[model samples]
Target: MNLVLRASILLLVLAGAPATAFAQDASDPIGNILDQVGQPAPATPTPPLPVPAPRAPPPAVARPTPAPPVAAPYPYGPRPQIAAPYAPSSSTYAPPPPNLSPSLAEPVFVDEYDRTPDRPMNSAEQGYENRMRSSFAAAQGMQGPLDGAWTLRSDAGQAVYTLLLVDKNNGRLEGAWRDPRRPGSRDSSGFLAAIQKIGTQLTASFYPSPGAGAVTLTLTPLGNGEWTGELTEGGARLGVVMSRN
Candidate 1:
């Protein structure tokens, strides 16, 4: 009688249980039939979610820079001065023609004094030549800061000389040269010359001209691009100043 009463009470308890508790679980096959056998079902552990590995960041793309505009160009200020890349000691030469002598090929441009064997330079004659030379020198205006007068002290005053440089090509120095010597002589056309720069200093020997003899000049460079020195001819040295043209 007691077993019959116990079984009846258990059947009433199960009948009163909620419907959601009796529901089937797909992941665990045994859970669906657990209540039929009357044993409490263990809680179905939720399978750990597969966390996706973080995706690698995309690589950055590179773009090319645009070229500058063609219609207009950028402007810089006033014209700049350019100095020669070479040192003053360099020189150039062309071999004299086999058939022609140096004098014939490279004749002295002109001689101011029409001196003959009988005719010679007197005090009056020198004064006139000096005046003409001074005038000739004054004709050319200073082309640049380097261009200036070459002055030597004389009894009368200062004797002026001009070495008017025009152009240079094929390593040759081209210009007009004048001193207390020659006829302000140029080698060829009014634009051509033969004043070779031997080493740093240029004596009258390098210059092709007619004079009393080789005119020796002991020139020292001044701080301001001008040269201060002495001109030694016939045993006397006179203060001289030379500059570039």
Candidate 2:
């Protein structure tokens, strides 16, 4: 009985002890190293900063202009001549003739009569024509041909006349006259005569009456020893034809 009681007490002590102590235990070094390697590493921290945009360039400027130029001019002067000097001749210079003929010695009078509209030439007509013809003949027939000038007297109610004689030698006429009662003397009779010639024919430009008693005569010569004349501007039909004798 005392032995049994000691065994029972030992068994009670073993039952109360820890299971781990009672259970079986195992240890493996390789399995422990594999577990540590499988675990992940720690993360790294970040650093922050600002970024810049791109830039551009500058612009340019302008300038001014210039001007132009000019030019110049010219000049002038005088001249010269050819011949010599001469004097004016006297109006009375007579040209000498080389030959003489009896026919030329006889005076030639150029006279034309205009009858009053339709009336015929009368005794007064014959008287005037004869007188002028004779006068011209007398002036030229003599050794001293007709003078360049002479006087003539007439009545109030008579015929008119004109006489022109050209000296063939000088180509100039010494005596040229016109009367109121003559053809082509339509103007007044009391002034100097008007005569003009073209080629060989001559004309007496008229002289109008100047109401009062003013007598005028114009005698102008055409350069080639020819002449032109007229007498008018008054009431009387009287005048003279004298040379520069």
Candidate 3:
């Protein structure tokens, strides 16, 4: 047979051969030879180098503006530029008169009403005391310890009251009070009236001025040495005080 045909036939025979026929044997000379050569030592596989992961980008930041320094709050900055004295641009604005006289006959109510002692009572004077008492009570009741001293209030007009605890045996209910602020009030030519008390309230009647000279006081007891009073007279109201001696 030709060489090619011979080789082909040998391959075919090898392929069709039973595994046992080709099985390496411990006693085989070929295997013993290959063992000596160590089968060229299997080519060592190279481990792939570890590639570094790509890094993430850093976050963006805003840059601040360089601002001018601010002035201090007090006496803030440099002296402000003073404006020049203005020259008259036009004659539209005028100066006011030096003596702008007031109307003399403007019905003169205030002085006329205040000084007219001979003026008769007006209807508006009614219930004057009730209103005054109510106000006084509200004011005085808010405070302290009034033991023996009684309170007097006016019903018709503002009055200066002088309460003298009269000895009942002598039939005289006499008392005295002075304007604490005014050095000597009794020397002011004001007439005197007697003071009388009637159940939680005191009444004083003076000659001539009927109710005009009457004074009403609201007394409040403040546990300690203090007491408060609200006094009302005519359309006006005043405050008063009485201290126990």
Most accurate candidate by lDDT? 1
Our tally of clashes for model 3 stands at: 18
lDDT of 1 by residue, 73-161 (tens): 33454455578796544356444345442233333333323323223455777899899988866654333232333444444455445
lDDT of each: 0.52, 0.45, 0.50
RMSD, one per candidate, in order:
24.1, 25.2, 22.3
The superposed Cα distance between candidate 1 and the true structure at residue 35, in angstroms, equals 99
Whole-structure CA lDDT of model 3: 0.50
Instruction: Work out candidate 1's RMSD over C-alphas.
Output: 24.1
Q: What's the distance in Å from true for residue 135, model 1?
A: 25
TM-score, ranked from best to worst: 1, 3, 2
Runs of candidate 2 with Cα error greater than 4 angstroms are 1-139, 142-169, 174-188, 191-193, 211-245
In model 1, the runs with Cα more than 4 Å from the true position are 1-157, 166-171, 179-200, 206-211, 243-245
Off by over 4 Å in 3: 1-164, 167-172, 184-186, 189-192, 205-213, 218-228
**lDDT value, residue 110 of candidate 2:** 40
| Pick by TM-score: 1 or 2, better one | 1
How many residue pairs clash (N, CA or C atoms closer than 3 angstroms) in each of the candidate models, in the order given? 0, 22, 18
Q: What local lDDT does model 1 show for residue 239?
A: 71
Compared with the true structure, what per-residue lDDT tens digits does model 2 show for residues 97-161?
A: 53332234323324323212223445777799789989976866652332243322233323333
